[model samples]
Target: MSAYVSVLPQKIPRQIAGSKSLASMLPTMLSTGVITLVATAVMRLLWLGFSNDFFGAWMEAWLTTWPIAFPVAYMLRPMLNHVSRSMSQPVVPIALPVRQGLMVSDIPHAAAEATRIAGLQVKSLSASRY
Candidate 1:
């Protein structure tokens, strides 16, 4: 109805200006998950349909090896977008942890100092260490 159309813009602006919205991102995430699931399912069904030992072995190997492809595609997407935007090549994202020694115990003081330095109000810090 006209009421829904009129209220939609107030809900979602044309430009979020570097902000992310769950409403917009959720569909993308869902589609990605669904595509991954469906592709795997279809490939599996096709592989299972073959009765020959050689083809069955091949299909089994293919299904087992398929997980490695997703990480490559996921890593490439940002790079491809940047490549399209400008001449800069995509940088590889390392899946390493940031710092080994820092944990939740170290967070309170650093967070408090950071808040103080940033001129933000300091609140009580509560933490539990195992």
Candidate 2:
């Protein structure tokens, strides 16, 4: 009987062997490649209709668009990420007047005041619902 032992590396490299900057760009490159390929194929199909030459046309369009898409996606990724992060954040509550015939901006304050007058602590809008 023969026994075989398999050994794994102590530490795996974070990236493949190549330029460090290229490694950082892998996500953007891959995403852009997929997006451009799908978009070009769809657009080509819509514009020219599916036919005998569809595959060739789609390939040409994808090849042309991918180069342009990659650079644009790489440059815009940071700004897009920032915008997405800001949009996903919870909105902060703002103070407004607590009075009758209040403006739209004062609805939350009026709601709070109504609850206060009713002897209920204003934990949140839902907390003070009638």
* Number of the predicted model whose lDDT against the real structure is largest: 2
Cα lDDT of model 1 by residue, 22-108, tens digit = 445544555555666666556666856645564566556555554555455555767877888886655656896557687788888
Worst lDDT run of 10 residues, candidate 2, spans: 93-102
Backbone clash pairs for candidate 2 read none
lDDT string, candidate 2, 63-119, tens digits:
998999899988998999999999999875577544567489878888888998999
Best by TM-score: 2
lDDT of 2 at 75: 90
TM-score of 2: 0.59
Please count the clashing residue pairs in each candidate, in the order shown. Answer: 0, 0
* Model 2 C-alpha lDDT versus the unseen true structure: 0.87
